[model samples]
Target: MRPTVTPCEDFNAEEDAKALKKAFKGFGTDEDAVIEIITKRSNEQRREIATVYKTMYGKDLVKDLRSELRGHFEDVIVALMLEPVEFQAKELHRAVSGLGTDELSIVEILGVHDNDEVVAISNAYEGLYQTSLESDIKGDTSGTLKRLLVGLSTGRRDESCDVNEEAAVKDAQALLQAGELLFAGTEESVFNSVLCQRARCQLRLIFDAYNNLVGHPIEKAIKNEFSGTVKDALLQLIECVRDRTSYLATRLHDSMAGIGTDDRTLIRIVVSRSEKDLEDIKEVYYEKYGKSLAERIADEEEVPSDVKKVLMQLLL
Candidate 1:
């Protein structure tokens, strides 16, 4: 995985803070300097800069950025400035708090993270909002999706890399019975238990065994048996476990294709993954869609040039 922002060798938190203050002080903000400092520094460095900026200027860095920047550029900068876990927690809160839930955002976050990451996000959520992530998910979602999100937020997935072939076979049969056979309606618990608790490696084995036993892929069974948000969540889990990069690539494509762009989704994926697997996502996107992610974004005449420039920088 290639990250756009790695640790800078000569990083000085105080100096970066001064530069940011200077950028914000003048009549017109030096957008380029703001972007250069915020996007190029590592997350840890950005956190440090926030602390120093507060100590030096008695002002909140994020608040200052919010005052100075506007539109998608502001969104990208603010998202990048936040600690990763806090950013994710905020995203979770944003997704679930409104009148209608952004189920895809909930799924993207809750489905993809591993046990440790989930635990961190849950903790961060409580810390930020003084409310439990589980409660928020339960309140926002209903039925099977509620159960699935709650299960995912538990952070109880088996973390072992070991694959139990015997257990894989048993789980495969269980999944087949629960999903594909006469016992279809009775499988929600089974789906929750196996999909939520098993390690990704073990799940892969189970999927292979399930395909061999049922004569088709587990995803096919999931699509045939489940519908609506529940099905979407389950399929997201499977796709994330199978190949996270590909899943994210598909999501990025979905955000940009046809109609108006899902700017929130676009910003979330680009900012969140830029320092993780965005390079891989970019490659997969190009391979799958026959156009580079950067190229696609550039083609969108509606997106601000500054925001597009930052996104392209991250992609590169």
Candidate 2:
């Protein structure tokens, strides 16, 4: 189900004027209360609060937030105020612009987002940031990372298109020639042009054929052939077509059970994937570790305790 999109009147201009005044009236800023309301409010609420804050105080909520709170708390609050796509674009921009690209951030966003989100993020990045995300990425990154991000940002994340058998055969041949082809246009292009291009049922047969020819799972082949951002994008495309829940479960497992739990990765996967398959992930999580996914997350220390708690609530 889509998240509730209702406008929250309680957090709008008039109400927020009262709330913000109250928040700032007592003492050296009630930081916890600031988090409590902002984090709990719906996105519409946050946007409304931003408008209210500016009109009421003649200062931006983000600016006020920066002055009031410090560290990741501020990041999360500001992120909440921006529209979701714009927020994601900002995150993408941040991932690439600083000292070095955060490949993990790239992977989490690319892998978990739906195709429409990927396209929207691309458009939003260019329009809002006044620069092409792809160009920025190219300047910042190198090697396979560059290739993969460029391919994904080219706006072909969805595999739900038409399939031509003759084209599929030809593409399949090309993949074979490339020797463990991983690039989206190379192996993935062929698959989409063929298998995923076909009707869903027919696509299964095509996938079977692909496995027979490759002597490995197509998904596994892509995994082995790609790494970092590109590997993530290809895997997400395949998972979108094949099995969403299993794919998410695998990602969640990789995040927590590895050498270390990547807090950002863990948070992104749980927050984004929860809407699609929380119950299924819970089942898989239990089956895989003989424990609830929530329990595993709770035990992990890297991710913020509050974020873990929020994820647990979302899971439940």
Which candidate achieves the best TM-score against the true structure? 1
lDDT of each: 0.88, 0.63
Can you give the TM-score per candidate against the true fold? 0.95, 0.73
Q: lDDT tens digits, residues 193-297, model 2?
A: 443234443444455656777787667766666566657655665664465566667678778775777555555555444444567777866886788887887
lDDT of 1: 0.88
**Which segments of model 1 are wrong by more than 4 Å?**
183-186
The number of the candidate with the highest lDDT is 1
RMSD of each: 1.5, 4.8
Residue-level lDDT tens digits of model 1 in 216-315: 8999988888898878878888998888889999999888878888888888899888888888888999999999999999998767899987887777
Model 1 pairs in collision: none
lDDT of 2 at 134: 83
